[model samples]
Target: MPIWVTEWALIDWFAGPDYPDSARQGEYAEASAAMMEELSIVERYAWFSLPYWDHIPSLGLYHPGPVATPAGEAYARAGG
Candidate 1:
């Protein structure tokens, strides 16, 4: 059974009220790099489930709801 981490949970954990919108603004470079290393380490031996493939927008991302977000921006850039 794959335990998928929900986008809502990630946003709540990383982009929470405690985290200033500006402060956590980045690709989270170090963390992303570590994840790559960890993924390579556990590619064969299972340790934990992978994260959700798609990302969801936070409350801030949508002003009134269902608006533009960086995720949406990236998606558009990708010709999504």
Candidate 2:
């Protein structure tokens, strides 16, 4: 069976034009890219739009049903 993975954009809460410079945004992007590359499932990634007040981007990871691991099994059972 093929494996599937998901990713989300994690933005910096303190990031803003008036705020001091920071690498938080870059770090998030890098981490997300690294995970996708490591899993070799970049296409499976999904990201939700950030709300006006929320800076973090919501992400979801989904794989085939009947997962082998307990966590995956639980997620599948939960219909996630």
Number of backbone-clashing residue pairs for each candidate, in the order shown: 0, 0
In terms of lDDT, the poorest run of 10 residues in model 2 is 52-61
* Candidate 1 runs further than 4 Å off: 7-17, 29-59, 71-80
Clashing residue pairs found in predicted model 1: none
**Model 1 lDDT, full chain set:** 0.31
Prediction 2 TM-score vs. true: 0.31
Worst 10 residues of 1 by lDDT: 44-53
Local accuracy of candidate 2 as per-residue lDDT tens digits, 3-37:
55543445344655232112443344445555665
Using lDDT as the measure, which candidate wins? Answer: 2
| Model 1 TM | 0.29
CA-lDDT, candidates in order:
0.31, 0.36
Q: What is the lDDT of candidate 2?
A: 0.36
Q: Residue 27 in candidate 1 has what lDDT?
A: 34
lDDT of 1 by residue, 1-80 (tens): 43433232123454453332312422332233345445534332221112212332232322234454443333233332
